[model samples]
Target: MTISLRSRHRWFSALQQLAQSIPYPLRGLLLGLLLWSTLTSAWINPDPVWQAFAPESAIAALGKLLFNGTLWPHIGASLQRVAVGLLAAIAVGVPVGLLFGLVPMIERSASGALQFIRMISPLSWMPIAVMAFGIGDLPVYFLLAIAAVWPILLSTSSGTAAVNHKLLLLARSLCATRSETIRRIVIPAIVPQILVGVRLAIGTIWIVLVPAEMLGVSSGLGYFILDTRDRIAYNELTAVLLAIGIIGCALDWSLQFLQKYWQPSR
Candidate 1:
C-alpha cells in the first residue's frame, strides 16, 4: 500500500511538471481540443434545435460553400464597407477629438450632448437612416460610421488630454508657435493613442457591419446569412457564423500587430 501511494504521488508530480512545461500555444490547442470534444458531444445529443447542423456537417457545408465560390464575394463586399466606413469615421473623429482635447470649453459644453447621443443605440437610427439616405450601401455606411466614430473620438480626446504638460510648457518657453508646437509635439504624442482608438473602432465597425449589410445590401456576409436562413440552409448559416468568428479573430490579430509595431517599446 505504501509503494502504491508513492507510485501515485510520482505520477501526479510528473503530470504536473509536464503541464507546466507545455508552451502556451500547446496549452491553447489542448483547450481547443477539450472545447471541440464538448461541442461534438452536444451535436451528437438528441436535441431538435441542434439537429439543424452538427459540427461535422457544418464543416462539410463550409467546405462545399468555399469550393462552390459562394463565399468570397460576400466577404469582399463586407470588407469594402468596413474600409470605407472606418476611413470616414477616422477622418471626422480625429479632428473633432483633437479640438475637444485642446479646448476645454468645447469639451465641457459638448460632453453632455455627445454622451446623450452616444447613449442612443446606433441601430435605432435604422429607420431614419433608410429614410434619409434611401436603400442600399448608404444606410449601411451611415450605421458603420456612427458605430465606429465614438471610440476614435473618445480615445483621441483622452490621449490628447494625457499629453505631457512639461513638453507643452517647454515648447512655449522656447517660443514655439501654436501651430509648430501642435504639429511637432502634440501630433506625435497623440498618434499612439489615435492608433489605439482606431483599433477599437475597427472592432466595433466589424461587429456592426453584418447587421447593417442585412438592410437591403445585395452582397455581404449579412445578406448571405439571411439568404441561408430563408433557403433553410442551416449548415450554411453555421458555416457563415464560423467564418465570421475566424475572420474577426484574424482582423483583431492584425490590429494587435499594427498596435505593437506602432508602439514597440510602449
Candidate 2:
C-alpha cells in the first residue's frame, strides 16, 4: 500500500511539473488540440455525410478562408457590433447602477419593473427591435445591448452597495464634493467589479451577436455562418464555428487579464 501510494504521488507530481513547464497560452492550445483530436477520432466515419465534417476538410477550409482574406471583413463587422453594444450598455448601466446604489428609495421603487424586464430574454426582443429599427445593424445593436446591460447594471450596483461606509464617511468629513467623492473614492474601488460585469457582458453580447447578425445584415460572422449553411458548405461552417470559439476565448482571456490587473490588493 505504501509503495502504491508513493508511485501515485510520483505520477501526479510528474504531471504537475509537465503542465507547469508549458507556457500558459501554449498549454491552452495543446489542450484544445487534444480535445479536437479526440472529437474527430470519435465522430469521423466512412459515411459520405460524415465526410463533410472530417477534421482535415474543416482545417483546409479554415486555411482557405484565412489565405483568401474572405474572413476578415466578417470578423471586423462582428467586432464592431460587439464594441458598439458593449459601450452602449456601459454608458446606460453604470450611471443607472450608481443611482440605484446611492439612492435606495429609488432602487426599491424600480426594482419590480426592472426585474420583470430583465427576466425576458434579449433574443425575444428581436421582432420588436426589427420592427422599430428596421432590418439593419440597428436592431442587432439593440439586441446585443439589451443582452449585455443586465450584468453590468447588477454588478455595478452590487459593488457600489458593498463600498466601505467608513471610507465614504471620511470623504464626507473631508468635505469632498459629490462628484469628487464618486470620481476618487467610488470609481476606483468599484473598478474590479465593473470589469467583472464587463467580462460577463462581453460573453453575453458575443453569444447574442451571432444570432442577431441574421437580422438582414449583409456582413458579419453570423451572416457568414448562415451563408455557409445555405451553400451547404459544411466544412466552412465547421471552420467558422471553430473561429467563433477561438475569438470568444480570446476576448474572455483579455477581460480576465484586465480584471486581475485591476483587482485590489489584500
Candidate 3:
C-alpha cells in the first residue's frame, strides 16, 4: 500500500510538472490524451466507429488507400476548387470593399442589400447553383465564392473606414492626388486587414468546399467520403475524415505563418 501510494504521488507530480511546462491553451491536449487512453480500453470490439479510430486500423486504411492510387486525384481536385474560389473572391471582394470603405454614401446605399444577401446561407443556394451552372465545378465555385466573399468585403470596408483621418489630411495638405493617396496610404494601411480577411475567407472556403463538392461532383474528399460510406469502407472513411482534419489544420497553419511573417509588427 505504501509503495502504491508513492507511485501515485510520483505520477501526479510528473503530470503537474508537465502541465506547468506547457501553455494554457495546449492543456486541453492532456485531457484528450486521458480520454484516448480510456477509450482504448473500451474499444476492444470491432465496432465500425471505434475500430475506425484504432491506430492500427487507421494506419492500414491509409496505406491501402495510398497504394491504390485513388486518393491524390480527389485531393488535387478539391484544392483546385479552393484555389479558384479563393482567387475569385479576392479579385471581386477587394475592389468592392475598397469602394464601400472610401465612399460612405455607397456603403449606406448598399448596406441593407448587402446585409440581406450576407444573411442568406451559401448551402441554401445549392439547387439554384446546380440549375444555373448545371452540375459541375461551376456550381461548386459559385457556392465557395458566395461563402468566402463576405468576410473579405466586410473586413476591407471596415479597414478602409478606419484609416487615420489625420494621415489623409496630411496627404491632402501635401497636394497628393486622390489616386496617389489611395495607392500609397490607403492600400498600405489596409494590408494587415486584408490579410486577416483572407485568412478568414480561406477557413470559410475550406469548410464550404466539402459539402459543396458533394453536389454531383465526381471527385473530391467529399465525394470520397460518400463513396466510402456506399461501399461500407468505414475504416477508410474515418481515415479520410482524419486526413481532411489534418490537411485543413495544415492549411490554416500555413496561412497563419504567412500572416505573421508579412504583418508589419513582426
Candidate 4:
C-alpha cells in the first residue's frame, strides 16, 4: 500500500512539472484550439440563423480587425481610461490608507462607513454618476475610480499595519522624524503591499470599465461591442470579446511580473 501511494505521488509530481514546463502562449493557443474545435463540432449543421456565430467567421473578423487598424482607437481609449482611473485610485486610496493604518481612532470611527460604501456596487451609482458628471469620460472615470479604490485602500492599510515594530523602534531610537521614518522605512516596507493593491485595483478597474464605457461614451471597447451588436456583426463582436479577455490577461500578467520583480530581496 505504501509503495502504491508513493508511486501515485511521483506520477502526479511529474505531470505537474510537465504542465508547468509548457509555455503560457502555447497553453493559450491550446485553449483557443479546444474552444474552436468545440464550436466547430457543435455547429456542424449550422442554420442561417447561427451563421454569424460560426467560428470561421469570427476568425476572419478578428484577422480583418487586426490587419486594418480598425480596433486600435478603441483599445487606446480604454487603456487611457484605465490609466486615469488607476492613478486617481492610487492618489486617493494610498493617503487615506496610511491615515487609517497610523491612527487607530480614525480607522475605528470610519470603518463602518467605509465598509458600507465599499459594499455598494460601483455600477449602482451609474445614474447618479451620469446625472452629476453629465456623460462623456467623466462619469466613466468616476465609476472606475470607485470600483478600484476599495481594494487599494484595504491592502495599503493592511500592509501598513503589518509593518515591523522592530523597525519602528529602531527609527525612534535614532531620533528620526516621523516624515523621515515613513519615507525611509514605512513606504519601502509596504511597497510589495502597494503593488498588491495596485494589481487588485487594476483588475477591478478593468471589469468596471466595460459597463462604464457603455454610459454614453463615443469611443472604447465597450462602445465597439455595442456598435457591432447594433450592426448585426456577431463575428466582430466575438472578436472584440476575445480581445478584451486577451488584454485583461496581459495586464494581469504584467502586474504579476512587476510584483515579483519588485519584491524585497531576502
Candidate 5:
C-alpha cells in the first residue's frame, strides 16, 4: 500500500511539474513558425523555393502576383467546398449527437453502425463520390463531409453523455423541463467538448481539401499545387504549400482562442 501510494504521488507530481514547465508563449512560437516557413526553407537548387527568394522586392512582386492575383479564386473555391461540407456536418452531427447523448435507445441502436462508418476511410469514398457526384464541386464537398463529420458527432455524443450529474440534479430541483434542462444545464456544459470536436473536424477537412480540390477543379490550392507541378513552378508550389500550412495553423489557433474565451474554466 505504501509503495502504491508513493508511485501514484510521484506520477502526479511529475505531471504537475511538466504542465507547469510549459512556456506561456508556446502559441506565439507556433504562430511564428507558420509565418517564417518561407524564410527558413533549405536550399534546393533548381527549385523555386530558393529562386522565389530572389530579391526581397522580386519575391514580394511574385508572391503578390501568386496570392493576390491568382490565389484568391482558388481560395474562394476551396472555401466554398469546406464551408458547405462543414456546415452540413455540423447540422447532421449536432442533432445526432443530441439523440445518442440523450437517448440510450438511440445510442444502443447506433453502436455497431457508427463504429462501422467511422472506421471507413473518407478517401475510400472517393470512387463512390466520383461515381455518384461526378467530377466537380459536389465530389469535393462530399469528400469534405465524409472526412469531417465523425469527430464532431462522436465528440458531441460523448460530451452529452458525460454531462455533470450535479448540474442535472440542480436543474431537476428547480423543476426544469427536459428542454430547459438540456438548453440551460447541458448545452453550456458540453460546448467546450463540442468545440474540441469542431477543432478536430476542421483539421481533418483542411488536410483533405487540397487533395480533394485536385480532382480537376479549376480553382483551389489543390489545383494550384497540380498546376505548379505541371508548369514546373516549384517555387509557386512551395509557396502554396506554405500558404496551406499557415492557413490551417491559423484556423486551429482561432478555434483554440474561441474555446479558451468561451470557457475560461477550461
Candidate 6:
C-alpha cells in the first residue's frame, strides 16, 4: 500500500510538472495542426468536406474576396448579436446567481424551475423567440442568451455558497454590514469560480454565434458559410471554415488569458 501510494504521488507530481512546462503558444499551434488535420483528412483523398488544398493563388484570391469583398459584413453582423446577447445574459445571470447562492430558500425555490428550463436547448426556443421577438436580431439574441446564461448563473451561485465559513464568521465578528460583506468578502472570494464560468460562457458563445446568426441574419460566419456553399465555392468554403476555427481558437485563448488574470486569491 505504501509503495503504491508513493508511486501515485510521483506520477501526479510528474504530470503537474509536465503540464506547467508546456508553453501556451506551442500548445495552441499543435491544437491548430490537429484541427487542420482532422478537417482536411478526407480532402487529402478526395472528400466532400474538403475538395482540395488547391493552388495557393486560387485559395489566396478566394480568401481575399472572402475577407474584403463579402465576408466582413456577415462576420460583423454575427459578432454584434453575440456580444449583445452574451452581455445581456451576464447582466441577468450574475445577479440571480448571487440571490440564489446567498439565500438557501431562494436557491431551493429556483432549483426545480431552473433545472427543468435548462434541459431545453436554446435552439428549441427558436420558434417561440422568432414569433415573440420577431425575425431579425432579437431571435438570434434570444438563442445566444439562453445558451450562455446557465453556466454563469450556476457558477456564481456555487461560488457564493462555497464562501469559507471561517471567512463568513470573521466578517460577522468585524460587524460588517450585509452589503459590505458581500461586496468585499463574497465577491472577491468567489471571483475565481465565477471566472471559470465566464470562460465556459465564452466558449459556448463562440460555438453558438454562427448558429445564432443563421436565423435570417444577413451577416456572420454562419451566413457566409451558407452563402459560399450556395455559390458552390468549395475551396473558399474550406478556407473560411479554417478561418472560423482560427477565430474561435483565438477567442478561447483570450478568455483563458483573462481567466488567469481574474483568478481570485486564496
Name the best candidate (by lDDT).
Answer: 2
Q: Tens digit of lDDT per residue, candidate 5, span 1-266?
A: 99999999999999999867878777576566544554544443455556553334334544775656787787777778888999988988888898899897989998898899889988888889999999889998988998888989989899999988888899999999999998887878889888999999999999899888877688888998899889877666766776787678888999999888896244
Using lDDT as the measure, name the better of candidate 2 and candidate 4.
2
Candidate 6 matches the true fold with a TM-score of: 0.79
How far residue 178's Cα lies from its native spot in candidate 1, in Å, is 2.6
**Number of backbone clashes in candidate 5:** 1
Q: Against the correct fold, how does model 1 do in TM-score?
A: 0.85
| lDDT tens per residue, model 6, 1-266 | 99999999999999999977989988887787666666566645465545354334235745786667666666677668777887988998888999988898999987999999999877888889888998788888888888889999999999999999898899999999899999989989888777777778878877877767777877778888788779888777766776777677877787778777774664
lDDT of each: 0.88, 0.91, 0.87, 0.89, 0.82, 0.79
Candidate 2 wrongly placed segments (more than 4 Å):
1-44, 263-266
Ranking by lDDT: 2, 4, 1, 3, 5, 6
TM-score of each: 0.85, 0.87, 0.87, 0.87, 0.76, 0.79
Of the candidates numbered 4 and 5, which has the greater TM-score value? 4
Please identify model 6 stretches exceeding 4 Å from their true place.
1-63, 66-69, 263-266
Model 4 worst lDDT window (10 residues): 40-49
Provide C-alpha RMSD values for all models, in order. 3.2, 4.5, 2.9, 6.0, 10.8, 9.0
Segments in model 5 whose C-alpha atoms lie over 4 Å from true places: 1-62, 66-68, 264-266
Candidate 1 lDDT score at position 176: 100
Q: Residue 71 in candidate 3 has what lDDT?
A: 86
For model 2, residues 1-266, the per-residue Cα lDDT tens digits are 99999999999999999989999989888887776655555355545655566567788898899899999899999999999999999999999988888888988999999999999999999999999999999999999999999999989998998899999999999999999989888888888888999999999999998999999999999999999999999989988988898899999999999987775642
lDDT value, candidate 4, whole model: 0.89
